[model samples]
Target: MINATILSMFSLSGLNDMTTKHRVTLFSFTLLCYCVILLVNSALIVTITLEEKLHEPMYIFLCNLCINSLYGTAAFYPKFLSDLLSNSHVISYTGCLLQVFVIYSYAATDFSILALMAYDRYVAICRPLEYHSVMTKHRVIWLVCFSRLVSLLCQAIVMIMTSKLELCGSHIEKLYCENWSILKLSCSSITINNIVGFIVIFFYFGHDLFIVCSYVQLVKSALKSREGRKKFTQTCLPHLLCLLNVTTALLFDLMYTRYGSASVPQSVKNFMAIQFLILPPLLNPIIYGLKLTQVRNSVLRLCRCRKQVKGLG
Candidate 1:
């Protein structure tokens, strides 16, 4: 039988190897990264919200994506910054679970939103005539809400199950709290947790497969005309790239968490641990903002408007 007393805190061992001399540099870089993520994502969200031309289904989805990025990073960056400047890297039990919920849910919603984007492109390119009727404003709002709700519910179940476990220890090897890392600490059998975890994984993997199939259809339709090809390159390509980036980042973290070798350098492991949080949030907005003509033009127009206002003042 496991002990009745639950652990109140966990020590994150990922930062144990860092020397004092390197801590300041690491902290500075991380802070700058977080600031940039905030600035770019906020800019995109504001631009999309304010630009009447960007009120369509695609840009609305992009705005939600940026919002998710901010939501996920908010859970990590502040705590991480504080930990970096402090000597100890400890998180409360409740706080740990909350982090798991926010970060993983953020990831799940990312995939969900990407899947929606794929379908949006599929309809836009493959069925252009029906695009307006199909992706109506009401439908777009519902889809966005569905993506976020599904992710939150799934992650909530995972967090609740994890909360019930009787942990054997409080030492987590990763830089941040994660569901799998916490499960590893359980003293009792986690058969139910494992089953539920697999179900969640399978559900999200199905989402990825759906995205792939949508893109396949998109590719087939795009090949039929030069205009279709241009549309796919301008819109679908950025979504594909963002999808690839997030998937690769998640895969690195999964491999490291599940089958990582102790022989690997701690620095490499740390990079793997935080890459998802770093890359997607920082790069996704930039990719869409620069690559998508609509977004680029809207952003430039907003800038010009602000510049003219400043000149008048």
Candidate 2:
């Protein structure tokens, strides 16, 4: 009875007034931003991978982050683009299921990468003497693989558990497929799915936030030594800003959805949507590159080299 009531309340609360023009405009802009983010992140990843100078643990984590961002974009943007291009925003049952899985998978992967990056920074700053042995290339590879595996397994379990519930309708009112949106579609009770989704969110977002904060604090404390202070601040500031932006965006999203008035203005939702979707990925590379002189120079040199190569080849 409690579960049924919750589902009823959720169904009643979900917005169903998405207009074609609004969706087309919003999705077009999202796609454009997505394209730019993809290009920039991919360029960074490629430059890092190709340039022998960037083979350190930090750049390796960045390359993994780039891949995770692409994974996330792949999971959602195709459907978003299709929804805009076609008048029908209806995704087939299979497609929706796939979207849910991949979206969560990439989300989990991203959290793990960020956490690992925090740890990488902690080691690089806090234990410079031990950094080389602690963060070997082999260890980094294994860590990434382990992170991917954990994320994939978690997403798989969540997807499988949620798949047991039957979707009764085709009206998903949100911009894209989300776990809650699918749950709202279920004719049956969704308590289990909601609980599982909460758990997943807690671990992915909540725990990651905890770990990043703790690691960053450790990095800051360890930077008091004269030798490590400058390098530590130089590296930590950009990541700290990135984390702050991401955390703020995520926290606002949660609060708005959970506690904000039911009749939140469409304008507010649109602002939140842009903040949540377009901003983090867009800013990540810029922040990361700007913080690191080496990365900044590398990007400039790579651009110049590319132009010259284009001119020659």
Candidate 3:
């Protein structure tokens, strides 16, 4: 087995699809999208932090969602934007692994946080009497931290397993670094890696199932009362949309990787590859910003406050 440590850099073949002439156009659009993501998520985060009324468990979890979106996107967008201009598309092996860790952990953390939010909602709706005792501010904070820690640990294990592989090559087929791409470069049998991958898959997908089941209970509890119905419509709808968006994006990527046709166009493949990274991060904040009444009102008030100050000045 060749020492995988001997491999230093890996070139990305995914960016080779489009002509160099179109890069500027693509870059501008991508930059705009990223800026919007930053703008919306930051606005939401600031609103949640400054407004004491928004300090409940649900809002705190939503704030964490926005913050995590920023955390996840930062790992990709900057490096991708750089590679957009540069002729060379290579990353150091260590850098590649680090990227895998960040990107994957971010994704895992996303599911974990969503599940936590679902639990928060379930408690609020289904167990209203016990909600105060169950989901204290400290408990929410602790759950947030615990979710990220578990995600990091899970991905850390994957990274370790991937890094130990005796890589046969350095050219990755994808636009960004990830486990499967690195696994493809391996010279050794990846049975253990594959096993760990399955375990992680089951682990995160468990989040989806938990959320769905929570919604089931929530709906049952909601149907009995008018106020419960209103709460479900306003709050749970956005959460469901977010879950669908993330789930769809992930399923697209997963299915394509596992069973997709080789002849499919690179553009489509690129979209599938980045669907989760781009859509959920961008959409989650927008969905929440618009759907949640309190947040919408706060943002409007915030805007008017800024306008008032400008007028006085």
Query: Which prediction has the highest TM-score against the true structure?
Result: 1
Q: What order do candidates take by lDDT, descending?
A: 1, 3, 2
Model 2 agreement with the true structure over 26-106: per-residue lDDT tens digits: 777878888898888888888887888998988888888777777777766676676566654565566767876886686
> In candidate 2, how many Å is residue 253 off?
3.5
> By descending TM-score, how would the candidates be arranged?
1, 3, 2
Evaluated against the true structure, the overall lDDT of model 2 is 0.72
Clashes of each: 0, 0, 0
The TM-scores, one per candidate, come to 0.98, 0.86, 0.97
Tens digits of per-residue lDDT for model 3, 1-313: 4655478899988889788878888899889999999999999999999899999999999999999999989989999999999989999989999988988788888899899989999999999999999999789889999999999999999998887788878888888987887887788799999999989989899899999899999999999999999999999999999999988888788778767898999888888999988999999999998999999999899989999999999
Candidate lDDT (C-alpha), each: 0.93, 0.72, 0.90
Candidate 1, position 221, lDDT: 96
Write out the backbone clash pairs for model 2: none
Lowest-scoring 10 consecutive residues by lDDT in candidate 2?
5-14
**Model 1, span 1-313: residue lDDT tens:** 6654578999998889998889999999999999999999999999999989899999999999999999999999999999989899999999999999999999999999999999999999999999999999999999999999999999999999899888888989988998899998888888899899889988987888999999889999999999999999999989999999999998899777888898999889999999999999999999999999999999999999999999999
Best by lDDT: 1
